[model samples]
Target: MPTVAVPQLSVADLDPATNLDAVTERVAALPDRVDVAVFPEYALTGFVADERACDAALERDGPELDRVRSVAAAHDLAVVAGYLERGAGDDRLYNALAYVAPDSDTTVYRKRHLWAGEADVVTAGDERVVVETPAGSTGLVTCYDLNFVGDSAAFAAERVDALFVAGAWPAAHSENWRLLLRARALDGVRWVVGAGRTGARNVPDAPLTEYAGRSAVVRPDGHVAAALSRGERDLVADLDPAVLAEQREFIPVLEATENDGSTRRNSRPGSRNKNGV
Candidate 1:
């Protein structure tokens, strides 16, 4: 069983320093029994509509991330936090998740799909990364990525044990957030751990938009095991591998349809890249 904690917190708009402090304190507060702590999208740098986003983008190897890594090392738990990344060639920016572990080097997963105002700000990612962790093999996805079934199926083909999601979905469509998570869980018979932001984003000269704020830990059986409607509370739950094993044994959903439903049992996994976004 892998104990996971999903912290439902608000992003301090364009303020990485304050967010970094929160991340440190939150990581330190988790119980030793927890193997990982997941933070919501833009956990460190909140989103902005225009070029001001460039100001929020941090280098992957920048001091900010080093600080996060140090905190993870000290706490002895994996931390998956959403952040804005500055491209090597100064391309644009990327909506990314930083998977910082105690024993391994940090793994960064960029968001493949950009939503609404995001397409103007960040470049899409090209690869599908399944990171192996102490608890299990897991895949990462940011906000808008949850709506795509192929992304969920792509990880299912890789046989990932879990999918960790970082989201800042709007309050108006909160049901979609919960719906899509369960759909993905059933799609792969795997655990879906989602951390969503709460509170309102007060960007200058723009209408204030409130976040959905319903963070959830969906079981392999597609049940909502634990969740937070709104607040700064942490949703902690132990994901039992046996539950996944039993679900696979009984339903065998992934076994029947492999790799985004393009390949059935004996078929070769699709040659083309399955765009998961």
Candidate 2:
């Protein structure tokens, strides 16, 4: 089992190009044996308020993604980050997660679920993507995508070992952030590694987008395994798929649910209410 490093990125001062450089440097500085480095949503470009800004978004093989690939290859690690994506033919843009593996072609997962005001600028994605890596079979999703049942359900069907979420989730809805992460972990029966942004971004008409940075790694049993500080910075934690299996076997909650869809009729294993009381 290898540890995944979640970097709570602060984009207050850095521009897209500067952020890429900073991210590359940060990834290079991590422990040499890390299997994956996860970054917050819109890690390269700060959240865009208007469609015009999204118009300036980069392509998958553009300079921004190229930089991420270079660092992942150099560090011998897989990298996952969110970015605004521009389509080649039309003016449509997408909120996308890019998975870059060392010496491999980059894979992009467009956000399947759109947030409020997001559909006005970006088109919704139709499919879920899972990339096979040395560490595990990994799936990627953006902020609001985690809220959609279909997205994670698709990943569950794929039997992915981990779900990497990159988000600009705001602090105002911290509870949603926490609950959604846990729910995704439980439903997918895999580790949920979330990397969220901190500080504020200028979005027109809406309040400044701020991230709570409760970014954490949730185990298959729906417990917070490890977390970063609330504001910003890097945190790492080891993830063992075997532990997930152990917990699942001990309780077999997912298996039971699969057998009978009635939650009220079945006694859940290791089940705790939200308060943990």
Q: Highest TM-score among the candidates is held by which one?
A: 1
Writing each residue's lDDT as its tens digit, candidate 1 over 1-277 gives 7899987888898899999999898888888999899999999998887888888888877899889889888888889999998976667788889888875367778888789878877788876666776557787888899888787878888787888999999999999999998888888888999999998899897669999999999988899999999888888999988988998888787776666533212111111123221
Model 2 misplacement above 4 A:
12-14, 203-206, 251-277
Q: Candidate 2's residue-wise lDDT over 154-239, tens digit each?
A: 66666667888897888899789889999999887888898978877765555566678888999988899988757667878888
lDDT of each: 0.83, 0.74
Clashing pairs for predicted structure model 1, backbone only? none
Provide TM-scores for the models. Answer: 0.92, 0.86
Worst 10 residues of 1 by lDDT: 263-272
